[model samples]
Target: MRREAVLKQSGCRHYRSQPTHGIGRYKHLLPPEPDPKKKDKLPRKEIKPSSDHEYGVLNLQVSGYNMILVEHYSQYVHNLCSRLSIKVQECYAKPTKTKEVMLMQEHSTKMFLDAMLTTHERVVQVTGLSSTMAPILMEVLMMNQPEGVQLLVKEHTEADYQVRFKGRPELENLVASMS
Candidate 1:
C-alpha cells in the first residue's frame, strides 16, 4: 500500500504508469501489479530424483571413405561389440550418404558432435581406412582439432547415460520432399 503511493508519486513510470495508452482513464482497472495476494498459487513442481542405476552404450562413431564403407565398418564394430558383450548405442545404424542431399547436414552433424563433446559424453570415433581418402579427411579434420585433445578426454561407464537422436527435420526430410 505505501509502496504503491511512493511509486505513483515518484514519477517511476515502470512500476507505476501515467494516464496514457488505451488505459488512459481506466488505468485503475488494470492495476500495475504482480500482486502477492492474487498470485495463482501454482503447485510447487516436485522433481523426482533420477535413479542411480542407468544403462548406456559406448558410442563408436564409424566414418570412412563413404557412407557405405562406414556402414560396413560399423557393422563389423557392432558384431565385435556384441561378441565382447559390450553395450553399443548403435547411433550409426543408418548412414546418411553424402550423395543424398541433406539440408545443412554438415553443419547439423558438426553441432551434434560439438554437443556430444561439451556434455563430456564418451565417444570414440573410428574412421575406416578404405584408401588414402581417409588420411586426407583425417588431416583436414585434425587441422581444426585442438592440440593435446587427450586433456579433453573424460571416462564413463555403460551406467552413465543413454544416447538417442531426436531426428532433425533438415537431415530427415528428403530432397524431393523439401521442395
Candidate 2:
C-alpha cells in the first residue's frame, strides 16, 4: 500500500507526513515570517551634534622598535583618516631614540655592551574631528595596530609642540628679560 493511503487508513489525525528531501525536511527549523504591519514603521534617525561645536585637535603617535613597521602603520592611519573624511593637519617623524643594552661579564664587576635598540616614532595630527567619530576612529586604528607598535592618542598642546625642539636656556632668559 502507498504511504498516504496507509496513513489515511490508520486514522492518525495528528501525524502529518513531511517531505523527506531537501529543505522541506527542515521546514520546522526555520524562523517565522515577520509581520507585514511592522515593516511599515521607519527606522529612527540618529541625532548628530551641531557644526559649531568644536571637538579640538588630536595627536596620534606611533612608536616601535622596528622602523619599517612604525612607518607603515603611520601611513595606514593617515590613509584611513583621509578615507573617513577627517582632516589630517600634518604627518611627521620625530627624531629616532637609541638605547644601549649592557651585560655583566661572568664573575666580574665589568659590563660590556650587548646590543643597541633604536625606537622610531611617527605622529599624525588630526583636526576638526567630531566628538562622536573620535572613539570610533581610535577603536579602528587600535584593532589594526601591528605587533610591537605602540599607539598613543592625546590632545595636542603647546608643550607637546615645544618638545620637538631643543630647549635653549639663554634664549628663554633673553625673552623673559625683554618681557
Candidate 3:
C-alpha cells in the first residue's frame, strides 16, 4: 500500500499531505510572557551604603625617634601637602586598617603647617570640616606632639581627632596624660 493512502485511511491528514516550508497556513506557537514584577526589581548584589571605609593617609614629621602628629584623615593633610608641592620622603604602612601610616616630610613642621593653612579654604571643602576648625586642629597637633613621638592615623578620615603620637617612653607618658 502507498504511504499517503495508508495515512489517509488512518484519518491522519498531516502525514497524508506534502510538507510545505513557509507557503502554507501554519499554527503559531508563542513563547510564554515574562513576569513584569521581576523585570522591574533592582539587583541585590550592589555595594552597601554603610561601607564607607576606604584607604586613608597619615601625615607625620618624624625626626629620629620623635614623631609628630601633623594631621588626620582631613583633606588638609593630602590637599595641603599636594598644594605645597612637597614630596614625601618616606611612607610606612600600618598594621591594620584602623591604624595609621607614617609619613615623613623633608621640611620642618612650621613650613609644612604654613602650606597647609595657606590652602585652608580648599582643605576645609575637601575634608568636610570648617575653615576655623582646621587651623585649631593643626594648632592642637603641633602643641601636643613632642620629640620622639610617632604620628599615627585612625583611617580614612584625616588627621583631626583621629591623629595620635606613638613611640618614645616620654611620648608614651605624654599620651597617657592626653587620656
Instruction: Please report the candidate that would top TM-score against the real structure.
Output: 2
RMSD per candidate (Å) reads 22.3, 22.2, 24.6
Model 3, residue 18: distance off in Å is 76
* Candidate 2: RMSD to truth: 22.2
Better lDDT candidate (2, 3): 2
Task: Judging by lDDT against the true structure, name the best candidate.
Answer: 2
Tell me the TM-score of model 1: 0.25
lDDT of 1 by residue, 4-47 (tens): 79877967554235445444456667868786777574343222
Cα error, residue 76 of model 3, in Å, equals 18
Measured with C-alpha atoms, the lDDT of residue 62 in candidate 1 is: 43
**lDDT tens digits, residues 86-125, model 2?**
9998888887889999999789999999999999999998
For all predicted structures, in order, the TM-scores are: 0.25, 0.62, 0.19
Q: For residues 47-150, could you state the per-residue lDDT of candidate 3 as single tens digits?
A: 21222332122234322221122223232345444454433322332312122334456764533222211111111212233334445545754575554434
What value of lDDT does candidate 1 attain over all alpha carbons?
Answer: 0.39
Single out the weakest 10-residue window by summed lDDT for candidate 1.
112-121
Instruction: Candidate 2: list runs displaced more than 4 Å.
Output: 1-54, 166-179
Model 1 misplaced stretches (Cα beyond 4 Å): 1-56, 89-91, 94-179
